[model samples]
Target: RANRDHAAGCVTPVISQNSLISSIAQNVLSINPFQQMINEIIKQKIAPLETRMQQLEEMVQDLQERNDCLNYKTNDLAQYQRRCAFHIYGIAENKEGNKNAIIKYIGKVMGVKVEDSDIYASHRLKQNKQGDDC
Candidate 1:
C-alpha cells in the first residue's frame, strides 16, 4: 500500500509539470499571432510616410540643380556686361564735358590709340564731400 501511494505521488508531480509546460506553450502561440498583427499594422502606417520622404528628397535635389543653373547664367550675363563697360577713376572733374581730352589722356597714359568714336558714352559722377567723383 505504501509503494502504491509513493508511485501515485510521483505520477501527480509529473502530470502537474506537463500541465504547466502545456499552458506556457499555448500562451506563447497566442502571443505570436498578436505580435505579428502589430508588426503588420506598424509597417502599413509607415509606408506612405517613407514614400513621401523620398519624393521630398527628389524635389530638393531638383531645386538645387535649378538654382545652380541660374547662378551660372547670372555670372555669364555679368561678364558680358563688363566686357562692354570700363570705369576710370582719379581724373579731375572737368565741367566742360572734356570727353575727347579724357580719351586722349587715357590713350597717352595706357600707350593705346583711342579715338572719340571708341567711347560710346562719357559722364562725370556726382562729387562726394571730399570733392572726388565716384
Candidate 2:
C-alpha cells in the first residue's frame, strides 16, 4: 500500500485472481444472489434435454417390439402351407395379404376373433389346410 502525501490517503489498490476465485467459491457455497441466478438458468436449460432423452428411449423400445413381432411372423409358417385352398383341397401360391385375410375368415368360422396374425399363425391348424385324412 502506498500512502499519499499530506492528508495520508491510499493510492490505487491491486486485485488478484486468487481473491476472485475465493469470493466466487464463497458465494456459491453460501447460496448468495449470484449463485441462485446461475442455478436457475442451468436448471431451465437442462429440463428440455431430459425430456428429449426420455422420448428417444421410448422410440427405441417401440422399434424393438415391432422387430420381435416381425421375426415371429416369418418363422412361424411356411410359404406353401400358408396358401392351401381349403374348399378345393389343392395348393396354390398365396399372396402375403391372402394368408392374412384367411385367418380372419377361419377365426369367424370357429366363433373366435384373432387380433394379431403373428400370434395366430403359429398354431398348426391355422397355418395349414383342413384335411379329410385327419
How would you encode candidate 2's per-residue C-alpha lDDT over 81-118 as one tens digit per residue? 65743442233446454655566667678998856634
At residue 91, what lDDT does model 2 achieve? 33
Query: lDDT (0-100) at residue 61 of candidate 2?
Result: 100
Sliding window of 10 residues with minimal summed lDDT for model 1 = 125-134
Identify the runs in model 1 with alpha carbons over 4 angstroms from their true place: 88-91, 96-134
| Alpha carbon deviation, residue 44, candidate 2 (Å) | 1.1
Error of 1 at 50 (Å): 0.8
Return the top candidate by TM-score: 1
